[model samples]
Target: MDKEDLKKLVQKIISNHQIGVLSSVENSKPHVRYMTFFMKDFILYTPTKKNTEKIEEIKNNPHVAALLGYVEKGSNDEYVEVTGICSISEDKDLKEEFWNDSFHNWFNGADDPNYVLMEIKPEAARILNSEHMKTMEITL
Candidate 1:
């Protein structure tokens, strides 16, 4: 697919999915967590806690993997795996844009000092469907 087609596919997959499993390396071991993701252009964003080991893991190793899909019995299987480099941003404007009360459940309420935001810029992505699958190298 061309760039425009690829972008459309990626955006469709992201919009159709809500949660993604984020994998990071922590002390040479793999750690995985569920995240609610938001996207802008081609960048992926998620929130986490500063106290969480995952935050430190990302700092130590920027490499990450993410999976987004719909899982239900007898449903057509569709999913995407995203490989990327990520960074932590403390930009006040971005923080405000992503803020939501629903995040309180994960951070034990909104005022939690440890709350942090992670921005993932994907370098590659693969989309898998029941009929076909394709992998594309991306420059984020």
Candidate 2:
């Protein structure tokens, strides 16, 4: 696919997916975990607590890889593999934007001091589809 078309497909896949695997280097090894994600202008954000282990890991190694949009549709499903620089955000507006009542399970609320947003600014990405088996690099 052309760059524009590949971008559309990547955006479509990301927009339809919310949960994914985010990996960070910890102790010189890769640590992967499921995370809930939202994106704005191709920048991914995941809500987390300031005290979480992942926060420290990201701090030590800003490089991260996230797998999004594989929702159990077998070989037909398309997913985006994103490699990005991760940073922690404590901005009030962003916190409110990503806030949800269900988050009370992990946080007191959006206003909680421990609540934070993990922002992933993609340096590069690839659209992976089983049927197509095409790996298209995207410059974000």
Candidate 3:
């Protein structure tokens, strides 16, 4: 597929999937956790708590990676590997845009001080699928 097609495929995968594994580094070791993500084009956003370990990890090491769109029982399972730099933000508009009741388990509401947004600006990505057992790079 061409770059444009790859971009569309990546966007479609992200749009179809809400949960992804976000990988970060801490104390020279790697840590990964499943997170609910909101994506706008190639940029991804995930809400997190201020006191979470991932917050500190991102603070120390801004580089991060994520895996999205995988299904255990599917033969044609396709996934995207996104590598990017993460930056934390407390933008109210963004918070309101991505907030949902499910997050209440972690924060009081959209205005909760503990709630923050982790923005991943993808520098590069690779879309993998079972069809050719190959990966295609999506140009950012």
What C-alpha lDDT do the candidate models reach, one value each? 0.77, 0.88, 0.89
Per-residue alpha-carbon lDDT of model 3 for 1-140, expressed as tens digits?
78887888888888888799999999998898999988886789999999999989998999999999997776688988899999998999999999999999999999999999999999998988846688888656
- Highest lDDT scorer: 3
| Regions more than 4 Å wrong, model 3 | 130-132
The sequence of per-residue lDDT tens digits that candidate 1 reaches over residues 1-140 is 67777667777878788688999998888899899887777888888878777777887999998888757662556777788998987666777787898887777544456677789898887767634444453444
> Model 2 off-target regions past 4 Å?
130-132
Q: For model 2, name the residue pairs that clash.
A: none
Model number with the top TM-score: 3
Model 1 error, position 87 (Å)? 0.8
> How accurate locally is residue 115 in candidate 1, as Cα lDDT from 0 to 100?
71
TM-score of each: 0.83, 0.92, 0.93
Better of 1 and 3 by lDDT: 3
Q: How many angstroms is residue 119 displaced in model 2 relative to the true structure, after the best TM-score fit?
A: 0.5
At residue 41, what lDDT does model 2 achieve?
Answer: 75
Top-down TM-score ranking: 3, 2, 1
